[model samples]
Every structure is written in structure tokens, then in C-alpha cells.
Target: MWQKSPNHQSLSEEEESKALKKAPSLRFRFILAGVLVIGIIASLAINLIFDYSQKLADLSYDRLLRSALLQMDENVGLIRNEVSIDIPWSAFATLAQAEEDRVFYKVESLEQGFITGYQDLNSFPPNPPVLDQIQFYDQMFSGEMVRFAWVQRYITDPETAQTVRIILGQTRLSREEMAAAVTQKAVEVVVLIALVAITLIIIGSHLVLRPLHRIERALEERVMGDLTPIDINTPKETHHLKVAINHFMARLQANLEQLENYTADAAHQLRTPLASLRALAENARDIGYSNSASPEKQHQALESIVQQCDTLSQTVTLLLNQAVVSHRLQTHRLELMDLLVPITASCREQALTALRQGVHLSLECELKESLILGDSFSIQQMMQNLIENAVRYSQQDQDAPAEVIVQVMEFDLFYRIKVIDYGEGIPESEKERVFERFYRGRYDVAGTGVGLSMVRDIVNHHSARVNILNTEPKGTTFQVDFAKHRFDGDNQ
Candidate 1:
């Protein structure tokens, strides 16, 4: 017994691992797809949240500026027919609570000079506001961005009333701080949700792909020679893969069994012929050593040895031919061809051999082309075997030359090949047994009995049929029929 070295085994294992790593992983792809989807949604949400937060901050702060202006308007009164106003210091107190920001207010008469408050705070609306309506606008003042509110008041002092305008401006420090705080809080929430979604995606992908992992482990743990079908649960989507793998294993198992049987049969068939050759050689050696041996006895022993060698050679040749046919049938694919080509070639190749044996081998084809789907090599071997078998048995008598004719004809639905031999026809009871491996009906005939068996194998591989029929009066005919339209290229 031999065992593989550890280093070689480890090398092979490493190679397998490399191959698996190179393969595209479904789990990784699934997770990547999920991550991409989540990323796109998160980006859109962050952008929208930023806009919403800024709008909310502006709405909350603008109300404070408007309230301060309204309180100042109530203080303007018409005293002595002239505009008089009492400045309210409490209005500034309300605006200072939100943030440390600069406040500027201006109270003035449109027709008169400044009344009270900052004279340089000129930020105002282009048009006077409607009565009881406060207008808000933004402008750059004193090198700082400010929010301003404007309102109009008609005050009478009993001498002459003047139109009073009150304006209030505040810097934007508080509004920016509030907007940043709100946006930060929203981003934190979005980050938490994104993390949770990514976690769930990883877990779900693992759960979905668990069945495939189980299948891999099952295959990896099996013995090298195991050919049994896998018996594990799988989802509906993966069922076809399991079925195909099992089918391939079953085919491999069948081929292995066939190889074992063929080996045993070949050994059994070679044993008898090899033993006879050894015995004849020993007898020839003994005859040469005998002191009283005659020339006739010595020649007879040599002749018998030569005859056994020929038989052994024929047996080995037939066995080899059978092996080649079997191997080719498994490996070769069939193609559209004309059956008459191989038949004519076989007749031509075997013509000299047949004439030497006092048998005339001839070919007769009535049709110009008899097409069938077949492997050319196997078909040629089949024809050669059939023609040789016919010639071997066609010698009826030594006085007249025996006739063996190979005929190719196209019938209504199939192509037929007939090998006719005018010799002692097979008995009805032994016609079927004649095709069995190594089964010889007549010991006097010089053959290995494997030729007809190989012919039958080739016929079956082509999905054709073969039959042995007795010719009228005294002869045997081997007929083979091939379906004309089974694999026709024209029909396809």
C-alpha cells in the first residue's frame, strides 16, 4: 500500500483554499449591496435634516426681535401736537436672554430728526410697513449680519401729529448657535439608526447563507472516494445544484463499476491462451532433448507452439480493440456522417486478408449516400469486426472460393448494412449466444469470439439495432439498422 506524503497533501489543501478565496462570495456581495442602499438613504436624510433644522432655528429667533419692536411702538405718544416717546429699557431685557448678541434700536420721525436711541442704526425696510403690520429683513450692519424688524405709528401731540417709525436690529450669533445644536442632535440620531441597520444586514445575510455553508462543510468532511448522494436540506433556489451534483456522482460510480468488471473479464480470458503457450514451449524443449525423438515429432511440437502464439495474439488484439471501442464511446461525441464511407473503407482494408484465406470480400452500395449520426472511429471499428467475422466463417469448402459481401442500402426510414457470408449458418438456438463475450460456438474456427461482442457494443452505443439472420439455403447475415432521422442536421 502507498500513502501520499504530508507535504503534498498540505500543498493541495492550500491550493484549494486559494481557489475558494478567489471565488465570488454571495454573503459578501449581499452585505455590500445592503450597505450601499443604507448609505444612499443616510446621505439624503442628513441633507434634509440640516435644512429643516436651519428653518426651525430662524422661526424661533425671529419672533423675539418682532416682540421688542412692538413694545417700543406702544410708548410713542402725541404730546403737545409733537411726537414724544418714552424709551422702554425692558424690551432689551427680553432679547438678551437667548444669546450674548448686540441689540440696536432706532426711534425716529419721518419728517423730523432722530427722536431717541442709536442715530447710526439706519437699517430699515425700503418701504414703510402697513399699519399694525411689522416687516422683517436681514442686512449687514457695523460689519456684522443682523436681523431687523420695522413698524409704523401715527402719533399726534394735539398741535401736529408726526409719523413715527421704530426699527430693531440684532446680530446673528444666537441663531447660528441654535441651528448648530439642533443639527448635531439630528445627526446623532441618524448615526444610531445607520449603525443598527448595518448590524441587522450583517446578521440577516449570515442567516440567509447558512445553508450553503453547511453544504460546503459536508463536502469537505467526506472521504475522497465517497460517491454517495448528498442528503441535506436546501432552499428551493439551490435544489437544482444539488440534483446536478448527485447525478454526476452517480454516473462516475457506474463507470468505476464497469471498469472493475472489464478488468476481471480480460484477465480470465487471457489465462487459458497464455497457459497453452507455456505448455507447448515446454513440450518443444522436451522433444529436442529426447535421444530417440524423430524429426516429425519435433516439427509437430514447433507447429503447435506457433499455432498457440497466433491464437494468443488474436485474443490480445480483440481485447485491445474492445477496450479502445469502450473508451472512445465514452469520450467521443457523434457527428452527422454517411454510414457507407466506413463500410467501404473496411471492405477495402480487409480485402487482401479475405483473399488470402480463399474468401472474396466485396462491397456493394446501391445508394450514393446513406447518412446517419455516428462516431466515425467506432463505426469503422464495428465494420472491421463484422467483415472479419464473416470472412473467418465463410470458407465452405477448399475447392471453390468463398464469397462474403458487404452491402449498404437506404430503406424508407433507416439505413441498413448487411454482411452476408455463404458458409455453415449459425444454429437458431445459438444465434443470440454467439454475440456473448468469449463464447465460441465452434472450436475449429480460428477466432477469439470477441469480435461480434464488440460489434454489438458499438451498435448499442449509436442507439442502433443489430440482428443475426440465416440466409436462405446455407449462410449467415449480420444486419445493422441506423435511424436516418434521429440526429439529422437538416431536421435540426
Candidate 2:
């Protein structure tokens, strides 16, 4: 049960401690999920930012085209009853700042042919725009994509009413260059945001799971049997877990203390009887070889020796049973123990003892359900102790049989094993103390006081109940409730 771990075979104390500290520090899965979710969100944000930057750059470039086209609008005026136009360099200078864009302009008549400017400019479709309205569109010009702005002048000439149309177009080299610059900056910002987001996520995840490492370190640093409570300086999210760990350690400490005390008490209680037995046997030997000693004296000494021997045997047996029960309960290791096996075996072993003592022993198991969970040896010891105790304490009736009835009955959740003896029942005041280790009750019976105590320990180990109640005719009955084991049809 206490075997070392296979991995620990090659590890020093410091190395094993380090290994324990490393395992519970951080979980990779949580960190991975956090990074993944943040990456997806950052990607979406970067896409939105990139698209917005492109639109902004395009809006700025479109305004430049509009400024150049407005300059052309001023060139229109009627002269000598004919439409006149003036071309200005300032009109094209704002768009020409890029030094790579090809700017073109055209002025024509709705009723007449071309008036001035670029003669090959494509005609602007649709009706003239509303007063002071300017229309902008994209078109392929001279085998290159161009941006155009169109304006119409509705002026009544002195001789005739006429509408004039003016259109301006520019190549896209400058606008595309501006958009590329904006896109480059936007991409740099997106990359920086991704790096910052991932870094924060890693840091935050480590901080959140740091308490788990604290708990692991706390457990690792403790020496053997150091079931101390953990510190409570923990995060609010993990406060409950820390408290639960402390509570578990407290329970463990208390149980270990109990086991330690039981060992001390057993050693103290057994030493006196063993010493007396040794002395009595030596006295019996001395009397047996004495020439002047009488037969009755030697016989009395022999009887004393036998009595002391029985007491020692009973004490040692009960002590061993207590230890076994304690070990099983501590380890929580048990198997399917048939209830009928112990009930039948204990009665068989105590039958002769009971008969010689004028106590009748009987078994009445009418219940079909008898399976239970416990160490078989511990269960058997408890049964024998209860039976022998009944035989010793039962008041002998001169005219009637002083019998001990072992009855087994079934209930919804448990099986009740009642060992009833028509003896002087225990008083109400001492009922609770009867189960104390080495508690010698008011009975003058020739037996060890540990039998009932061992019985109680075994009962607790199996998580069963033992009730001491009075019989109908002023006697005692020890009724033990053993929980039925959960078994399938195959096991049965």
C-alpha cells in the first residue's frame, strides 16, 4: 500500500518537488483557447480598419478631383453671342501635385458641337445636373481608368437660349498611390494590435490560474503527516476550492490523531496483562516442581495460569481486530463480505463456550438478503465479540433456557442482525460508554473489556449501526444494522 511511485525511483527530493510544482502551474488548453478567440476578434477588427482606411483615402482623392473640375466651371461665359471659354493652369494644379496624373478637360454645347478643351473627351450622359450640382463618375479613357466630374451651365444667350456642358477627367495613378500608403499604415496597426492582444491574454491567463500553483506548492512543501490547512489569500473565484482543501486536511489530521492515540492506548492496556501472564506461568512452573507443595495448591496455580492465558489471548485478538478495522477504514479498501458467513461462523465457534456456560446460542436468519461490504475478518471478529458478550452477560434462568438468539431481518435499505440474550441488560447511563476502548462495565464476567469496543470500531468501519435495546423479559439485545451491499445478479 505504501509502495513508491515508479517515476519517483530515479528522482531526488528536490527534483521530485520541482516536478510536482511544474505540473499544476498552468494548463496549456486554457491559454490556447484564450489566444485563439482573441486572434479571431483581432482579425475581424483589422479587416474593418483596413476597409475604413481605404475608403477614407479614396474620399480625400475624390475631393481633389472635384476642386480641379470646379475651376473649369468658372471658364464658361458668353462672348459676342457665342459661348467663350478660358483654360486655367490652377484648375489642374491641385490634381497635378502628384506629378504623375494625366488631367483632361472638355467643353461642349448641347445643341452645337465641341466648343473648347480636350476634343476627344467622351460625352457626359444623363440630363444636365440641377443648379450648381456636379456629377462625378469613373470611366475608361485612353486605355486607363479615369475619374470624371461633369457640370452644366443653363444660360440664356442674348440672341438664343442655350445650355453648355463641361466635363473633366483624371487618371488614377495618384489616388491609387495614396490608398496604398494608407493601407500600409493600417496593416502595421493591425499587426501591433494582434501582438499586444496575444501578450495580454497570455499574461491574464497565467494570473488567473496562479492560485492552482500556490495550492500545489503548499502541498508539496509539507512533510509527511503534515495535514495542515492551506492559506486563504486566494482569488475570489477560487476561494471555495481553497476552503474545501483546508476542511479536508483538518479531517485528515483528526483521523490521524485518533489512530495515534489508539495505538498508544492499546500498548498501555496490553502490557500489564502480558506481564501478569508471564509471572503467573512462572509461578505455575515453580509450584509444579516443588516437592513440598500440595496438589490443590498446584492445581489452583494452574487454573490461575489458564485464566491469565485466556485473558492475554482475548486481548491480543481484540487488539489485532481493532488494528485491521482501522487500516481498512483508513484505506477505504473493502470487498463483498457475505453477511451469513460471519453470522454462521461466529455462532459455531461460540456454541461450545456458550453450552459449557449454560447459555443457549441459536441463529434465526429468515431474510434472503444478506450481502454486505466489509473486511470479512473484521466482520467475523465483530460477530464473535457480540455473541460472546451476550453469553457472558445473559442472566441464567433456573427453570427456563438462558438463550442467545441471533436473528437476521431485512429492511428497505439495510439488514438488521440482532443478538438477543436474556441477560441483565445494560443500564441507560452506561450505554454510551460501553463502546469505549478498555471500558470495563459493571458486569463481573471473566472476559476482556475490549470486546464491545472492538465491536463498535468494526461497526463504524463498515458504516453500520448497533443499537442496544432491552428485550421483552428484562434482558439485553444488541441489534446491529448492516447496510446491504449493492450487487448485481451475476455476483449473487
Candidate 3:
């Protein structure tokens, strides 16, 4: 019923293309993840470098403002109990070292109101500093960010004391430029490192996946329909994959061999019957044309043609059953089942087939159930073929009463099935040859010679043994023995 399509190859190719597109590339994913991790780490490093540079730049410039404030504090005096001060030239000179920056300074007396330089500098709310101590702060003055250092001093002449404040501020142009330069250098180094890491990621991923590429190339180079086992050197990680592929190919090779044999045998065995049918049909046509020939002769020719057709149909059926059993032996998984089921079923079917021969077929299964690890389809095929072989040979003698007996017996270690036929027994010389494909004995019986061959194959598949023995008076008994405990421990 299941036939291979004419365009099966093309459809498989299309499906393979779709599958490749849908499958994610392992190398590409690894590289992408590595790049993403490098990008995140590089960004964090850049931010940390920027912050460190900004703090370093600020530390360098704050010392200059403090020196200028200290110099101005030393120049303050308390003459006539009133605040008086002379600003030092060195204080302003030190502030002028930053060429691109603007500077501002102020000196004031708290109790006596505004004193010496830059009264408008009061825009910054001044916090009183500890005596003789310097305090630094920053603020926006005249639309520019400024850094300021403040210092306070008290002068006493035994009459009255006055508190004076010295403050100096500078624009932050040079400090900002220094921080930007340091950050730019660090960023360049980080970008270079990231690029190097990404390049290494690509190379490493390629090396790790080289084995897979080798396997693909090996398969691509093989000829189509080559089911031989693949032999190639591979790493331990991929060795199991190679083994699995070899196993699959071995099964496929076996199936193809079975199909080829079935096709050839079916053609060879069916040829004679087909040719006989054609001859009978031609003979019947000739008999009809002859006026001298009686109608009874034409009827006899028609009957012979019908008989040939039946033989052809039976041969075809046996060939198909052989093919089905061979295929199932390759593909079907064995399971725990009762062996008696197929045996009884085969007995019933063969009994109906032998009814026309006036042969009495009987089943003798004493056990309720005989459990075994086996493929049911193959077991059924074996039973059917064995019983059919017996039924065909049992009706050889027309004088004696024909009888075929199918028996199932169980033992401690194994199970035995026997098909006994009361017919002209087979000689010891031809017993083994009868199991060969299309090898029939010299008996006038309707048969295709495929049943016994199928039985032999099924027996070999189950690792069982078969024997043929002559009965007491006149008959042949085909005995098949199967081990009961085969693969039972493996299941556990």
C-alpha cells in the first residue's frame, strides 16, 4: 500500500533545504555571544576610566587655588584695630599659570563689613572657615563654573581682634581639557582590545566546529544510494555520531538487499505460471475457432486457464508476504507478547485454506499463554508460512485421509512449535534444500516455494533453530525451537 513516489528525491531535497535554514548555526551563535559580552565589558571599562580621569584632573588643579589663598592670608594685618591688607603679587602670579583660564579673588572682614578686593564676589554665600584653615568649594560665577578656596585669619594687638577672609576662584577650562584627553586615550585602548577579542572569538569558533565540517564534506563526496558504513577519523565528541550514522546505513543496506532479492525471485518464480496462462488463453482461442473441436474441449481449456490464474495469484501473494516479513524484520521492534496468539491465528486461517483439499487441520495449544520477546508481525509470518507449507504437502495422497496438526509446547527453558503433515515424507537429502528460496520438492502440490524460505528467515531473525524429522509411519514434522528467556534480563 505504501509506494515510493516518482518525485520523492526532489521533495526530500526541498525539505532538507528548509531544515538547514531553520537550524541555528552553532559557530555563529558562539561568536555573537562572545561579541556581546566583550561590548558590555568594554562599555563598563570606558565609563570607569572616564570617572577616574575626571577625579585625577580635579586633584591636580585644586592645589593651585589653595596656594593663592594661603599667600593672601599672610598679607593681612590689624593696624589701628581696623583690618588692613596688602595683596601679594606672587598670589596672582601663581593663579595665572593656567593660561586659558580666568581667575577671581576677594578679601573681606566679617564684623567691619566689606574690605579690600572684588566686593561683587559676595554672590557666593561664604561659610566661615576654621581659624587659619583652608576650605575649598565650587560654584557658577558670571556664567562660568569656578573652583574656589577660602581661608580665614584672626589678628590681635592686645586692644581688639578682627577676623579676615581670603577667597580665590578660577574657571575650570584647563581641568576639563585634561580629563577629556585622559578619557580619549583610555577609550582608544579599550576599542583596540575589543576588536582583538572579537577576532579571536571568530577563529576559536571555527576551530571548534571543524570536525562537523569534515563530516559534512565526507557525506557530500559519497555517491548517491551508497549505504556503506562511513569510515573516517574523528574526535571523541563526534565518534558517537559517526557510529550512529553507520548503524542506520547498515540497516538501510540490509533493507535494499532484501528488496532486490524479492524482486528477482518474484520475477523468476512467476514467469512459468504467467507463461502457462498465456498458452492456455491462446489454446482456448484456437479451440473456439475450430468447428471440428467440441464445446467441451474449449471449456476444458478455460478451466486450465483459470487454474493457472489461481497459481499466479497465489505466487504473487506469497512473494508479497515474504517482502512484508523481510521489511518488518528490519524495522519492527520486538516486544513482550504471547507466542500462542499468532500460532492459533495461523492454524485457523490454514484450516480454512485446506478445507478444499478435504484436509482436517487441528491446533493443540495446551498453555494459556507463552510469553516471549519477539516481533509479532514476524512471528505471525513464521506461523502462517509453516502451517501453509504443511497443509500443502499433507494432501499429497488422495487415498488416505489428509490431516495437518499444529502444536505449541512449553518447557522450562524454551518453547517448541511443530507442524506435522501425514503425506509423502521428504528425503533427508532434500530436507535442507527445501528451505532455500524457490526450491520445491518433487510433489504434485500447489505451492510457490516461498513459504519455507520465509520461515527460515524469520527463524534466523529470532535466533531460533528449526529441524525436519520423519514421522513414525509416513509424514514430515517441521520443528521450531525458541529460547524463552532471550532478552528478558536486558528488559529489566
Candidate 4:
């Protein structure tokens, strides 16, 4: 016969208690979300600023080119004559040098052809001729892309009836350079705006999140088991969440108070009945007429009284344990292995009794020695109750070989303990009620109805879980799962 090894890594009650204390609160997540939203908005604003600045630079460059074209048009008449034009280059030079020095001027007549300064410098005629006003064109000049502004003026020679079209055009390198400079300056301004926007976002986010931080600090300073409403003066944006949290805390505080009262009241009520039954049993044993009254009858009465007393005692114990488990469930660390050993030991006597009644009792432990953080005592009590219930419900008739099987296995993040009995299984309808306190099945059996309920309370205390499955071939199985615990020592 192989002795099953206990789950060594099971969390003790103390460990399960510690875990509930470490869960993060909602306010911390809220602050992180707010910061993320601000960061996204800042990024979008920076892109928009850069785009708007580029548009402004293009508009300003077009305006400057038009103004330079108008100045050349006003001076064209003074420099043009039929067949013998004496164009003073100084007038175009003055206009070119005034605003942008990278300008190149040219004068052309259909009859005279290219006949002025900068005309041989790769100049091209403007498209969509400007009859009386300036037209802007982008063209390649001297192997360099340039913007040009030009106008064509038709002048009739007063003495000769011949018409001369004077074309005046200026290369726009200076305008292009000024536009580039303006665009650079706009980029610097947009960068400064983006920096300022980011700074404002950071500062505003901090101010907005300040109230949440206050609420968080208030919650952090609170003592364990303290479910007081958080007192915080917050913006309207946060009021709904604050109110919801406060309401939940208020209800929790009330529930805890009621549970405390129930435990105290139940303990006080059950103690006197147990004491009286013990006293009556003691007196019956001391009375000297035992053989005269029939020893068997006397013994039977005494045994009945003792059994009732035990039932009462167990009830009170279960209730008190439930109270303690509930409190610890609010804050506890649990180890599954630590819980299994004691539960198995506690149920050994019960198992042996079942075996004597022709029922086989076998427990198979297959879980790895995994650690968990939880309420060990509650976990053990849960296991004890489950195993005891299985044994109690198992059929003892010799015709059918009744059996109770307990198995422990591990899955990801949970340690599973299953207690299976081959007896009259629970009906589907009664399965849910089995875990309710003081609820018993209609089957005729001696039970206080608190065992399964106590098991549930213990499982809940560690924030663990439980399930019941109706096994095939007329039997029932109870499965309890405690949260898995990792071993840090080996890694260290």
C-alpha cells in the first residue's frame, strides 16, 4: 500500500490572508488611464500645429511673389521702345534687391528676342500669358527649380502704328528663399506650441488626478477589516465612481457587523444546551440502579443524549469557524497542501468507521508539492466536512460494496481535492441547496445539516472554489479547488 504524500506547497491560512491585502485598488487604474488619454491628445495637437504652420508659409510666399510682379509691371513702360529699347536695368535691379536678392530679371520682345540681363540664364516664358497682370510660374532656370512672376504689356508706338509686346519677368530665388525662411520660423513656432501643449497636458492631468490620489491614499491608510466610506473632495467628473465605492463600502461594513452579531448570538444560545446535556449524562452514569433498570437501555439513553450534545457542539463550532473563515476570506493567504494534511488526518476516524461497515475508504494524492497562500484551518475543515459527508451518506448493506474515494490533483493556478462516494447520489434539484447552511436532503440520515455549508464557508474564506458532480453508477463527488501557490525559494 502506497502512503500518499501530502501537498507540501499548500498555502496556510496566514498566507491566504496576506494575498487579499495586496490586490490593487480601482483608483490606481483610473489615474493610469487618464495619463494615457492626455498623452494621445498631446500627440494629435502637435501634428495639427505643424500642418497649419506649413499652410500659412505657402500662402505668404504666394502673396510676396504677386507684389514683386506688380512693381516690375509699373516700370516696364519707361524701359521699352520699338526696335531700339533702352531698358534701364537699375529699375528692375532696385525692385529685385529691395525684397529678395536672388531675383533674375529679363526683357524680351517677339521681334528683338532675349535682349536683357539674366535672359541667357535658362529663363523660360511664362505659361498662360499674363496680358496686363502678374502671373506666377515654377520653372527650371540654370539647372535649378525657380519660381517666376512676369507680365506681358502691348505698347503701340505713337509714330509708327506697329505694336510691340514687352515681356518683363523676374526669377524668384529670393522669394523662394524668404518662403523657406518663413517656413523654418513657422516650424520653430509650432514646436514651441507643441512643447507648451505637452506641458499643459502634464500639469492638467496631475491636477485632474489629484482627487483620485487623495482617495487612494485614504484607502491605503485604512486598517484591515475597515470598510469605511472614503472621504474625498473630488471634481464632478469623479463623483459617480466615488459614490459607488462609498456605497459598496457602506454595505460591506454592515454585512461584517451583522456577521459578527450572528456569531456572538449563535454561540451564546447553543452553549447552555450542550452543558445541560453533558450534566444529565454525568448524573445518569452516577445513579446506582443501572442493572435494575437494564444496562443496555440506560446506555442507549446516555448515548443518545451524548450524540445530541455532540451535534449541538459541532453546529456551534461550524458556525464560529464560518465566521472566522469569512473574516479571513476578506484578507488571507492559503496553501493547499497545508490544508490537505490536517483535513485527511481529521477524517481518518470517520473513514475507518465507514470501512468497518463494509465500505472501502481510499485517498489518492497526485498533486505536486505546490504551495498556496490561504486560510489553512478553514481549508482543512472544508475537506473534513466533505469527506465526512461522503462517508455518512454511503450505503452500508453488504450486498453492495460501498466506497469513498478522496483524490488530490493540481491544475494551472489551482489545487483540486475530490471526495467521491459510491452510494445514493444527490438529485439534480438538491445539488445547489447542498451548500446552503442548515439545508439537508430528504434522505433519512443523521446529520446536523451544517457540514456542507461549513465546507463552503471555509472554501470561500480562502477565495477558493468548490463543485459537486453526481458520479455515474449512483454516487456523488465533491470537488474543492484552492488557488495554486508558487515556490519562490528554489528560484531564489
Give the candidate number with the greatest TM-score: 1
Candidate 2 on 1-492: residue-level lDDT in tens?
134676675566668788887775445777788678877887787778678766776688778878877777777777766777787788777887768989887888876769987898875646656756888777888889887888887767668766888888888788788777777787787778778877887787788888988888888777776776786488888899989988988878877787788788788768888888889889988988899999999989989988887887887777777677777667767787778887888999999899998888999987654778877777788889899888877744444458999998888778999999877678998899899876877645666577788788788877989999998776788989988886577467
In candidate 2, which residue pairs get closer than 3 Å at backbone N, Cα or C atoms, i.e. clash? 394-423, 395-423
lDDT of 4 by residue, 1-492 (tens): 123235533544456668757877455565556556655765676566456654554455556556555554445442345444555555455555536435556666665566565757544454666566566567776665666666666755565333234433444555555556665775566567656765676577677778888888888788777776777788898898799999988878777786776666576657756786877777677653555766766777787687777777676776777667666666665544565566567568567777776667887886446567766666666766777777777863334447888888878778788889877788999999988765879536766666786677667666777888987766898987877666677458
Q: What does candidate 3's lDDT look like per residue over 400-424, in tens digits? A: 4588888889987789998888888
Expressed as tens digits, the lDDT of each residue in 1-492 for candidate 1 is 124699988998899899998999888899999999999999899999889887887788888877778777878887666677786777887798776889888888888869887899887686766966788888998999988888886776546778888888888888888888998999999989998999999999988888778878878788877889999999986788788889988988887887887787789878988898999999999999999999999999999999898888878877887888888898888888988788888888999999998888988887887778898778989999988888888875454349898888787789889999888889999998998987999988887777888888899999999999987667899999998955546567
Task: Report every candidate's CA lDDT.
Answer: 0.85, 0.80, 0.84, 0.66
Query: What total of clashing residue pairs does each candidate reach?
Result: 5, 2, 0, 31
In candidate 3, position 439 carries an lDDT of 85
Assess the local accuracy of residue 152 in candidate 1 as a C-alpha lDDT between 0 and 100.
80
Global CA lDDT computed for model 3:
0.84
Ranking by lDDT: 1, 3, 2, 4
- Candidate 1 residue runs with Cα over 4 Å from true position: 1-3, 33-198, 366-370, 396-401, 485-492
TM-score preference between candidates 1 and 2, better one: 1
| Poorest 10 consecutive residues by lDDT, candidate 4 | 160-169
TM-score of each: 0.67, 0.65, 0.63, 0.48
Instruction: Tell me how far candidate 1 lies from the true structure as C-alpha RMSD in angstroms.
Output: 7.5
Give the lDDT of residue 490 in candidate 2. Answer: 41
Best by the lDDT measure: 1
